[model samples]
Target: MSKSNDAISQLTEKLPILLIEDDITIRRFVEINLKRSGFQVMAADSGETGLSLMENRRPALVVLDVMLPGIDGYQVCSQIRDRFPEVAVLMLTALSQDLDKVMGFEFGADDYLVKPFNPLELVARIRAILRRFNKDSGSLLCSGSFRCDLRAQQLFMDEREIELTPQEFRLIKVFLEHRGQALSRDDLLNLAWGEDFVGDPKTVDVHVRRLREKIGNAPSTGRIETVWGSGYRWREGS
Candidate 1:
């Protein structure tokens, strides 16, 4: 793995992110910001490369650009949604056309961003999406032989208390709250970091690893399954 990949793997163990933009300058700029915010970022300069990386890296979230040489952002987003339904996509476009936005959403974009946007605001939006959509509001969650106390922001395994960092606690809470559902890195990012968050998805992965360690779960035990071409999920009866 390259240094970037190593960094991403480490962070995905906490946070994992993918950025697909044809513009080199913008890609580098966003990658820098995301890395600084404690995320692992994977970058591809074209829609084709982006899609290929998505298949191999399985990033939690994807930042896709609308215009590209081969596959446009809309087409790419649609492909991801169809093949990797769990992955969360955020479409970036220069056009402000309402129809364009609608098209992005229709193609399964979780969020949309116009050019010349504030990086900070983008980060915030990412966090919001993760919080709202990553979590399953319909079901209660249990993990590590313990149940989560959402009201108290605590985890209990085997009747013993396990302390969790605020981020870890929140991540686990989301998983438990949405038990049995797969949450993409973007989903976690939107929930934990916010929609406008410029951070990388690797940050979410790292946090997840820590969460698993704290909960006494193995990474490959199916407690938290990695959905190839998508993100992660907290499986029931793992």
Candidate 2:
């Protein structure tokens, strides 16, 4: 066998997901659909079981419903963010309120979608999140106690995982790849969101703020410094 082929085999790993929804119908539907789409899924009808699965299973991402019996989604999301910072969370809610969105974001949800959601849309959202995260730098990256697992798309501080949203994960990947250089909001838009994205560049600012909050001093720069007139840069050294 070719050396590269052997190396690839050695590194390949499965990306599993967890779904926490109280409704039996939705849970089975999502679980089956996720499996059909080639993702290994772990399903739970309660937040307690979901948390239990998370501890034992260590899923890479979670599809969580906001409304659930016992320990609601918001609190569960909070707990997940606090305990497993590396696991990505996608919040499912029935409410279309801006307040609901704000609450989810504040509680560390990576993505939020309304109920009666399209199965395909949920699949697509999951794919997008994983795609952003799946970019392996081809080597383990580190600065201080923080380590980046390129293969798994997970960040760890002193071995504890640090959760990051898909956008935030992409942002860090971009920054690390361009370390020592100042990246303007536009540059970030192109790199992180891709040139195809027609959204405003100001959105980059929001994700950056969120990323900084989660990664904290783990960044080589100790902080993502504001570039004043230009944008932001993940400078090396504190």
Candidate 3:
């Protein structure tokens, strides 16, 4: 362990993080940066070591590199998601293609970052994810058996918790905030993915379908209403 790791271990008493990357230079750079940003960082040089640490320490979040020596980041992320669903995984890699990002999400990564990344920006992203996860876990909003707590970024039905991706959470929030009002696909694109994001409206439709599958279990009187020609709306009472 390096001196920075020692400092991080002491300073980040409650903010445990697992960093899995094969590059020594990059790992050192990230470890130092994370320590400066107030995160207790545990590093692994390979996916196998990362998994062993994960089984033992169970960090609050994982910063994983997709191109690892053994097993690969996707396999590691899938294993983590299957075994420890609450732990958040953020994929940090050199692969920046849209397909790579989609693959990371499919493998259960919470966020994806292309490498040669800015150190300060990485810190900021980590903070935002942690803040969202912490907030969602502690509070919930209820309307009948359906519940959504913006803090936890979670939804529930009949007291049963539902898992939602970050994109799904943003979409649901937009609908809930403007309940009963029709929102166009463009409106959702701006709200969920930001005005600068260049993606087709069909992305919103795909996310909505996933959200409905998770939260729309009851038959009829659905929570989300689809308009024939326009967009969609959240029903006030359904």
Candidate 4:
């Protein structure tokens, strides 16, 4: 490989992967496999240590197990999103229900992996999540006057940064990904909140109300229209 290519490969392989799984056997197995694959692995048996490692080591991706002793994966995931917005999260859990999965996504996990998962598949999902974020570094998502810098994970309207909560950012991300298309509340929930959210559709309404307020009266973004009987749509043009 060329020098530049070799450097890139090393960086990719060395990209930190923190595994916060309580099961000793499972943690060891995963850590070994990840090490074999050339990833820098940090295995934490509890959520507290994992969070500590996150603060200290600053891993690029976190492989979090949902059912921790005290804090649990959901809370850990929430803290991760709140503290390290750029770090990608992949949840590993024995809870395979759709609601469980939705809850995982609601906590801001980039991907979910059920227990008894193939080691290869787990690694592949991690790679996919990392690539998804990596590929967007310099790209932009725009609708009217609102523009999102994918690399920077920041939104701007008329050249000013639009402060957004993690949930709002994820919601806007869904809208930008499916720009010009109307998304039902369920669709929005699934796309933005993940499939495990088994709550009232009204929840979507509540968030949308808040989101519209945050986005404000900008012309391009003004096209964020309610479809009356349906859900919502972000119209792109005149």
The CA lDDT of each predicted structure is 0.70, 0.77, 0.76, 0.77
Q: Write the residue-wise lDDT of candidate 1 on 1-238 in tens digits.
A: 5985455345443557789988889888888887776667899998888888877778777889999888899889878866765567778889987767766655656677899888876665555554443433344356546677665555677667776644566677767767678788989877665555654455665667666666655533336667787888787654
lDDT of 4 by residue, 180-235 (tens): 78899999978766564434565576667666777874554545678888899887
lDDT for model 1, on a 0 to 1 scale?
A: 0.70
For model 4 the local lDDT of residue 204 reads 70
**How well does candidate 1 score on lDDT at residue 119?**
81
lDDT of 3 by residue, 11-91 (tens): 444578999999999999999999886788999999899989988888888999999987999999888876777787888
Cα-based lDDT at residue 28, candidate 1: 88
lDDT of 2 by residue, 1-238 (tens): 5985444323322588899999998899989898887788889999999999988889889999999999999999989987887778889999987778777767777677788888988877776666555556577766555567677777777788877755566677778777668989999878886654444455677678788777775544355778999999876655
Q: What is the lDDT of residue 212 in candidate 4?
A: 76
Among all windows of 10 consecutive residues in model 4, the one with the lowest summed lDDT is 128-137
Q: Model 3 scores what on Cα lDDT? A: 0.76
Determine which window of 10 residues in candidate 2 has minimal summed lDDT: 5-14
User: What's the lDDT for candidate 2?
Assistant: 0.77
Task: List where candidate 3 sits over 4 angstroms from the true fold.
Answer: 1-14, 136-139, 149-155, 163-178, 182-209, 216-221, 225-232
TM-score (C-alpha, index-matched) for candidate 4: 0.72
Residue-level error in angstroms, candidate 4, position 29? 0.8
